[model samples]
Target chain A: MIATDPTPADRSLLATLDRVLRGNFTRREALATGRIDLPVGRLIGLCLLLGAIYGICLGSYSAFNGTGHAWLQTLASALKVPLLFVLTLLVSFPSLYVFAALQRLPLDFRNTLKLMLLAVLVDLTVIASLGPVFAFFAASSTSYAFLLLLNVAIFALGGVLGLAVLRRATRDVFTPVPPGKALEPAAPVEPGATPPVLPPALSLPAPSSRTAHQAADQARRLLAAWCVVYGVVGAQMGWLLRPFLGNPGAPFEWFRAREDNFLVAVLRTIGNLFGR
Target chain B: MNFATDENLLRGGADVTPSARACLGVGAAGCALAGLGLGAAAGDVRTALFAAIKVPLLIAFVAGLCLPSFFVVNTVLGLRDDFRAACRGLLAAQATLGIALGAQAPMLVFLGASVLDPYLLTLCDAVQFGAATWAAQRVLARHYAPLLARDARHRHALRGWLVLFAFTGVQVAWVLRPFRGTEGFPVQFLRPEAFEQNAYVVLLDHCLRLLR
Candidate 1:
């Protein structure tokens, strides 16, 4: 922990969140500038707090709440969504870090971890924001599959937004960019034209403009890798931690085989819905 | 257990009492008993009793798979004293999980009495467990934050260690299946069924099955 807390003028959580949500890198850039060093502890704390809040809001919904234990489960539901999100990130971060390093984009694990958490924070916020709507549908809907699909859609949408936030934040921390400027791809170089050389006095992205593109590509690849790992781990984790949504058709038991994973079974059933 | 923890533990020194250990044991056990166990809410007393008996074994089963790799990770990362700390932290997380799950026992009982359909009961069971386990993970992360703090040189390795946790945890969990009672299965201490293939293959099959 820092001896002195960041002064209010330096930055606020809300301001940074707004920046992150909008895919603006100013706040993170500020972090890079050393104007404010948000403690990793604080960042993680905020992430967990957001996770808890998000879980509580979204946990209240049920495709069917007629069961005797539904209310109790709903009470604990607040913890469920955040659990899945944070757990997925934890499960996936290591591989992504490996891939980023392989790309030679030498990422600080702490900063990368911070960005990963922030992305999930964005995700949970979106999910929480949609909680009320989903809750309404869950309350009214009788079709478990339809409600499940609706939630899957919302989660995916939120994930896309969150990954975008992470992507923007990653660029800011992994590669230093000049203050007060956007990371626009450098003007297409004219073949055989002498490159415009600015004096070394000003801080700028030192690497060739091509490296910027490479970093962007690198970040994209890293995200995809993380996403795939997260997807598989998350789905299996969900399966292992089974009975999340409660199977209306079967008696309440714990985990089943890996073969019964929600992802595959749902996808298969959905595919069959069309094929048949 | 105490010696293993104190003499050469993973992350930090172990800090647990016999009573504390018993408490975690009883808590997880009680959950599996009384028709209020984790994974699946027991539909009947017979099932609950069967699960209750295996709660301790279940913990060991998971740890057996995870700890060896975890130790290797700590050594490779050169987190010497942190090894005990890590082990302590993991056990503490498990205890925290047991406590959280125990906290919801009343509600689970309420649901058992009230809900008629198995699906709602099962989902609630899974969701509550998720809440409890996530809470445990938060504690574990806090413990590692410091150990992994000085891990700047090997951020990739540190991440790999964390990945090790997830990989082992999920696979171990997969093998220790029937956390919820599977459909049409009798209440048994362990499922007694063996995997037709390894978990990876099975998982891959699941993926491939989706394409079909």
Candidate 2:
């Protein structure tokens, strides 16, 4: 039979995973920790100064690329940029809130940024590889199947990475403390002296059996609130924008002009109802 | 508390903590460099650099928000705050990256085309294939480093690397295969009709209307 106690290796792995999930420290915090000899804060300040210079270089490059009509290009880019940001932000918000709400762990902003960078890296990687393969096939007079495959591949990879990262975060964040081991001091103390008393605000209450049930109830209530808010807001917005987004062309023409099949007619009817 | 007491308290207290801060800074800088490298290789310096800067900012913001939530949840559950912090950090990092990409799609497209030259485009393609392999290896290494480090499991990492290589090879083959004697995969996928009706076209039309 397997031993009841966790192996040392398992413990170490768990600890490492914990560290990866929780932050190591912020630069300012590290300065206080005095763990390292170097003045990290000063270094970070210097880096920020350099970053400002880098931004100017990038802006100059943008101007060189004929995107100098700043007002127009900026306006155009800004419109689409926010739409994409909101879409992603909306999709990922639930996971973020759930991790924070359910787990109560400190989020590492730096690592979050790294993950974003990683996703972009992955996207670029896929695009890079796919470009050549497409070229080779095109040169060889191949079928267009590769295009569909490539798109599917890219989407699948992005989805997997997003899900993995989120799932890992959720699991790490919500990992339950084993019963009977929940109320220990955060730091070890010497035997002869009084234990280091955590500030009452920071000291966690002992885990009660009912707490899990209470958290579940809270989660349900929060989700319900979200649903109601989205439903009402969505309907109101759609109502307001209806005129601008209203169908301009004849609904019948869309189906009848293209094909006269029964399925097309049925689809056209449904489309018209929604479109109106 | 008095000013002296407050200063002492602040000094003693770990708001950000040392280890966490170091990890964040190093991770951010590494990501920035990786982004820049990828951008340069792809010939879209602007998109890459923007990604680099934006990612770190998003990480910092998300991490700050999630830390309190993590503290609350862990406190309730009687879990250690350290564990909670770790989980929050990882999630924040992942989410920040994803959001940054979504925010920068237009810049990516515009600069992607502008940056690529005949020679660089070829290099970009090769690098892309290699990147898939690189990513797979990194994931495996990260998830199973301890196990892989042992004598018995050392070969497993190599096996993982091989799997990625095999996957890339198949992709390369699929890309190079022949079907009809005409256009390539990208051209075929980018239908002319669809291109004509795209947002860019609409924007151009709007501009023309304004000019008129």
Q: Which candidate should be chosen as best, given TM-score against the real structure? A: 1
lDDT of 2 by residue, A1-276 (tens): 011233465345323223222322212222121122222333233223322322232222223233334333323322322232234434554554454344432334333333332222222222322333322222322212232233234334433433333333323322334333322333454587564322221122343443555545543454354334433443333222211111212121111222344334335544543333
TM-score, every prediction: 0.45, 0.27
Taking the candidates in order, what DockQ does each have? 0.01, 0.02
The residue ranges of model 2 lying beyond 4 angstroms of the native Cα positions read: A1-86, A91-145, A176-276, B1-160, B171-212
Off by over 4 Å in 1: A1-5, A8-28, A31-36, A62-64, A172-175, A178-211, A249-258, A269-276, B1-212
- Model 2's chain A TM-score stands at 0.30
Q: Is the docking of candidate 2 incorrect, acceptable, medium or high quality?
A: incorrect
Candidate 1: Cα lDDT at B9? 22
lDDT of 1 by residue, B1-212 (tens): 23332222223323432234553564454345423344345465555555555544555555554454344334323454466666656666665566566666677667766676887876777687688778666666665566567565234334544564454445454445555465577766555533222344455457778989
TM-scores for chain A over all candidates: 0.72, 0.30
